[model samples]
Target: MRLSTVILPVRRWSEGGRDQWLRAESLGFHTAYTYDHLSWRSFREKTWFGAVPTLTAAAAVTSRLRLGTLVTSPNFRHPVTLAKELITLDDVSGGRVTLGIGAGGNGFDATTLGQEPWTPRERADHFGEFVPLLDRLLSEDSVSYDGTHYSAVEARNIPGCVQRPRLPFAVAATGPRGLKLAARHGQAWVTTGDPKLFEAGTPEQSLEAIAGQIGKLGAACEEIGRDVEELDKILLTGFTPDRGRPLESLDAFVDFAGRHFVLGITEIVVHAPIADSDFAADEKVFEQIATEGLAQLAG
Candidate 1:
């Protein structure tokens, strides 16, 4: 399985965030990601940077490692605007950008943007239009679309993406509707296991449950006549202390990745520890994890 690291822009100066991602690339990570949130919860009181610019800066600094947002939703972004930004990022990264998208959630982003509270079904409906229109706008020369939530009038995509047929999409999905959407449009499907299970269970249990989610994704693909193996599987953990702490130990991490690899996970994206203070300490801990983790994999 490929391995990735997510260096959050939370509480880090732009330079520190860029440095951490650079460090991740030096340590042999396959891809580097930053969280795409507008003032993430609790951390709202702290410094949080925008995902697009941070990723743009990251692309400028790193040459080999692929860069992207952990997942960007349609919460505060229109597909047309996002498509333009993504193409620019892809060009800057030399065609090394992956778009990780989701149905979005009710968080600080929604409220801050003055968006109405949307039900899960409504979000799914919005995504149904969002993905396809974005795909067309990126791939076609001039497109016109009138959808329920989004619209484009003869949109021009001049000097198209660095990657032909647009950039790769790593769609995040857990529910059936979302899974079907990902199967239809994504190059990869990303999940974080079952939230209920992860909250009350041990690390082993959470990791074990991911296989079930993979199975559900396969079923989703089958219903849509899409080949399951054609899509990459990515897991995003390390948000909670319980989820993040297990990977601190080298052996635990190797086994963690190995177990998911067996379940058909193509990549594991672990988040860097929140840098409330002592950024150096957080960096050191991640350095050890990445160093030993790669060594273990190589062995």
Candidate 2:
């Protein structure tokens, strides 16, 4: 039931965005994550910083607010490189780093730049293979792997990560395979949306869908002989509405978040105002919304 904040796909990073997260730490946020997609949300533009480095910047200034990828693509980088990146960030964050890995979104952002296209099944298989390597690299001095799309030498990760065996790993999943993968391997399961109201659809339908997803995750854990209770479920939602939107007044964003977020796990992560709404105009607006939004969610 812990609350985490996230940066979404259709969002951009501004100086104001950086400040927004800084304020998040003092606001009592447990985790702060960002996307690592190459494709932009609206257009086909690329975001700055591949992913790990941007979090590096987030960790540099904040003493609290755990840093991680909202969901780093399994295909975008190799396991060795990913392990290295997670280790480095863990070092910088004093072991307060989590790694949110996933198959990534399928859009111009992921498949553009002449990258390969993977069937959903392929990505799930790849993720299943990728996760175990993370543990192997972190736990052992040397390792070997021979999988469908991966091959690693008996290479030593050298000194390992700051979090000892490895850092926590989370996943963003909404499909059968993704759900099972998230349940079997991920320390946590995160989804993107607004918890207060169905930012995407009717609230009742969304609630039903969310409850179904959680049930599937629990079933997946059962299939694998793992206890679903051992894992945490987190929803990444922009619960606080714009100042005067229809749901804005009724938003009681905090209470709404509590309602939807508690559907299964009894807790959820609430995202706030976006970073790209009005870059130039909302500089102060970002500060104001983030400050108040933090209090609303935390309180």
Per model, state how many residue pairs clash. 0, 3
Q: RMSD of candidate 2 to the true fold?
A: 4.4
For each candidate, what TM-score against the reference? 0.92, 0.81
Model 1, 95-125: lDDT tens digits are 9999999988898877776778688888898
- Badly placed stretches (over 4 Å) of model 2 are 8-18, 193-200, 238-251, 275-299
Model 1 segments beyond 4 Å from truth? 11-15, 239-242, 277-282
Model 2: lDDT of residue 97: 88
- What tens digits encode model 2's per-residue C-alpha lDDT throughout 1-299? 46566654342446465676677787666777776776555534533445777788778888878887777777567887777777778888888888877776566554676677777787788877787777687767788888787778886777777776678778777777877877766788876533444444565665666787788888989998999878777765542232223124323545555566567554344444554542123334433444454456556
Assess each prediction's global lDDT (C-alpha) against the native.
0.81, 0.66
Worst 10 residues of 2 by lDDT: 239-248
- State in Å the error of residue 238, model 1: 2.0
Error of 2 at 276 (Å): 5.2
